[model samples]
Target: MKSLVLCTFLLISLAGCAQNNKKEMNQNYSTEEQEVINVTDHLTELMIAKDLKGLNNLLDKDFTLTHITGYLQPKAEWLKEIETESMKYYSFKPVNRKIEINENKAEVIQQNILDARIWGTRNHWHLQQIFQLEKRNDDWVILSSVASIF
Candidate 1:
């Protein structure tokens, strides 16, 4: 009877440990996802603020932006538009967001309603943006993006 009780106790203890480890793993994934989300939020904030220096730090050297009109803009041209106030963003209302991470690379899809003025014309647009990011030197940087208007 004593041996039986001892074996049962050991089994319960092991099960508890397994449960705890699983919970820890789930928490770790959640933390990683949140970190990615925070980086994306900061990117939008920088765009709205027109912080060119901050944007420069977040964007990779080969960053490219594909517009809804199917035109591709390199980092320099995109930065020039922001600097010249040609693409002015008043606000962004995120409708849906999804993120996927694989090792050091991540992709984020965001659907948003944007209140903006482009080249002196006021517009409210429903936009879908796909952002690709890479982790470099312990920092997350935007690698490229494609944007479409719906």
Candidate 2:
């Protein structure tokens, strides 16, 4: 009974999220919102491609990545993990997303089925990240990311 219940729960959860490689979500986004989306999309690409330098250009100096386990990983350490492949991202399928901007700050919530090997566990994680970004010199740069399950 427990096994059947667990399987049913898992299936229901996966049904709500994207399982394909089609990345784009909504087409009627405002121009400002689209700019913010572009930044985050580039971020995902950089992560999967393991381009640390390019990723650095898009993040703030005091950037942080908060994992689902509530571990607050500093940017330097996270980059090191990516460099060493302790955290390796393969691909992302964004199912749902939203962006809100106030003045020069933007908050983006994105849910994706991400294929990755993290800390030796490889799975297609139903990942959701609340990313904080700030506009500096007319460019949107990620300040932090708080991750959770979809």
Candidate 3:
């Protein structure tokens, strides 16, 4: 009984420590960096929700998506694929983020566990997406995203 009680206490303490560490890591970023991260997180939400209009508004006119296979998909075509459910995103969870800002431009490397169906194959993919963004008229616009397996 004592061993079980001790183990339970240790588990609870470790969980609390993890929560504190996550909060501390988030606090390390500046307000501007958080804004950029928000845009990227919003993109994941939009993707999973299949919000084509929202995605379109958040992205640049000349945006592109580079797949892990080295295929560069143009914005219109990619949106069309999503609209047609060819490239369907079911859910996503962001696990890590890194953002760098220079003037009005930023680069965000976000790691996610993404549940998606692409070209008829469904899998939970560990994805690392590098997104290029630019601030325009007080709003951030995603310029492009290149995806790779992490």
TM agreement with the true structure for every prediction: 0.77, 0.84, 0.86
Clashing pairs in 2: none
lDDT of 1 by residue, 1-150 (tens): 999999999999999987776456335446667677778778778889999999999999999999988999999999999999999878876666788999999998877788878778878889888999988887889999899975
Q: Score each candidate by Cα lDDT.
A: 0.85, 0.92, 0.93
Q: How much lDDT does candidate 2 score?
A: 0.92
Worst ten in a row by lDDT for model 1 = 22-31
Report the lDDT tens digits of candidate 3 across residue range 38-64.
899899899888899999999999999
Candidate 1 lDDT (Cα, whole model)?
A: 0.85
On residues 11-63, what C-alpha lDDT tens digit does candidate 2 reach at each position? 97776543322433656688899999889989999999999999999999999
* Pairs that collide, model 1: none
Off by over 4 Å in 3: 1-22
Sort the predicted structures by lDDT, highest score first. 3, 2, 1
